[model samples]
Target: MVKVATTPLDRTRVARAALKLLNETGLEGLSLRAIAKELDVKAPALYWHFKDKQALLDEMATEMLRRMNEELAADEQPDTEWPDALSAALRGLRRHLLMYRDGAKVYSGTRFTDMSYAAPMEAHLRMLTGGGFTPGAAARAWLTGYSYTIGYVIEEQSMGPDPVKEEGGYDLAARAERLAAYPLAAAAGDEMFRDYDAGFEKGLAAVVAGIGATMRDAPGA
Candidate 1:
């Protein structure tokens, strides 16, 4: 006979518990039963709110986006520079995602059609439009910036902590030395490794600059 688990679950409580578990166990270790246990509810109860694990995962992604939405509202509102404003908003989102384990993984491929995400998305579009970008160009710009932010953070998080294990660990240094044949890689070295926030800022700025340049060069926009 199979043993069954016991716990209470609802959408709100389960989602909250799921996020907590995600922070602790990461996406690979996440499970419906694990979340049910966190909420002190039966696995079946969790099923009532979420049809399956994928649904739960999707909801978790939404929760992360909602947190980003809140931060952008408070800190990344439309400013004098539309590109900078969009970049800042995306960087803010990356910061929030970094707060959790496998956060970018969870957010990746998740859809943001919910009304909650619409306001921010619309604001970004409006800001781009105000900057003289055509609708098609604005959409591309938004996607490009968003993808860059997400891709950067995903790679940043996957690299895990510094590869250096011991105080005198040569893992990083040796790796750097081995890249001598690759001029760009060797030149990057420690300079490429940066504080998460700084990386986000730098990347965001670069992407925004690229978009601005493109917009300026576009004909009849």
Candidate 2:
């Protein structure tokens, strides 16, 4: 694909260009100068739009959140049960993060610079609270799930082509053999490095179920 020689630089343009730079050079190699070159603009000119690399990164993060909010807004089923709603929301987040190169790292490392960016978060809080969860419980419920998904994706992206195992990564067979003294945990050797999708779903369900239980058992519940 032919990249545009130069962009009519703006926050959105700069941020998108930086994401392109990220695709070419990872987070370690990404720099303001690199993005500036991608935009066909001078390094100093980039400062006129973004104060620094961090400022550009904040916009990139905002871009991810923007996509997430758009996804949530189009759901048409926001009032669904908290578990389903939470699952959909979290999955949407993961999908958006997985869109760009090193997306999870870019998203997790930068904070939202837009005040309006909190819409989905607020909406989730309301859903939980309406579902019999106390205000605090609602906040914790969403945050716990959100944190887990982001953390999982970050680790997934960091693994490069080999997500579950490196050359010297976890040796399930060796550990299982060594742990033969305890047959139960030892039996989980292959299970440990099995499909991440299945494992993540299980953990997410547990979190959602725990929230429901927590609300049910709450003082006035």
Candidate 3:
């Protein structure tokens, strides 16, 4: 058995250290032991603060959301339309997720460790409700946008974080060769794999439009 450290550690400090290590190692290689070494402590030292890896992940995701919220708040405008506000929020989420390797994976399913998420979420719902959507419609609209943001980031990170800068990650020529039997599918690879920024914006625009068309009703209007 390994020895435990007697020194006390702050949970946020441990989580922040883990976030930095995440960029170097990616999610598959991150472990409590690795984090302990990063902090120059024994593995058991982490257990006192985090019961297990999942608990630590919860905190990490929470911290990521907190930072994202801070950024969004800085850019927020009181008079902005609901669609623009929602788009900005999701765009902010994507930017933050792309900051770390497997950042989307780290954030996707983990539960937040605190109530910090409440304010931002409530604000979003209120924005939708104020825009003339029913409560149920507002909730659904927010979820649809949030889900798209998370899913898009997951795929974006899969090609290596910063697919734009990663060299030789997607071999369009080889992919086309393999799909020679299906010329259309082969030709589609470039549009699908390259220029993620434009693709994301186009897709998000469609999602927001659909939400507005389908959900913006006064019930009695």
What is the TM-score of each predicted model, taking all chains together?
0.81, 0.79, 0.92
lDDT of each: 0.74, 0.75, 0.87
Off by over 4 Å in 1: 1-8, 76-79, 162-170, 177-187, 216-221
> What local lDDT score does residue 1 receive in model 2, on the 0 to 100 scale?
94
| Candidate 1 colliding pairs | 7-40, 7-41, 7-42, 8-40, 8-41
Q: Least accurate stretch of 10 residues (summed lDDT) in model 3? A: 160-169
Best by TM-score: 3
Candidate 2 per-residue lDDT, tens place, 1-221, comes to: 98867446788888887877777677888998888787778899888978877888899999767766776698749548777888888888887776766788888767788875676778888877777788888888887888989887776566434322333345677888899999989987556455656866887788778767765334335
What lDDT score goes with residue 70 in model 1?
74
Looking at candidate 1, what is the lDDT of residue 180? 75
Q: For model 3, how big is the CA root-mean-square deviation?
A: 4.0
2 or 3, greater by TM-score: 3
**Model 2, runs deviating above 4 Å:** 1-7, 160-189, 215-221
Spell out the clash pairs found in candidate 2.
none
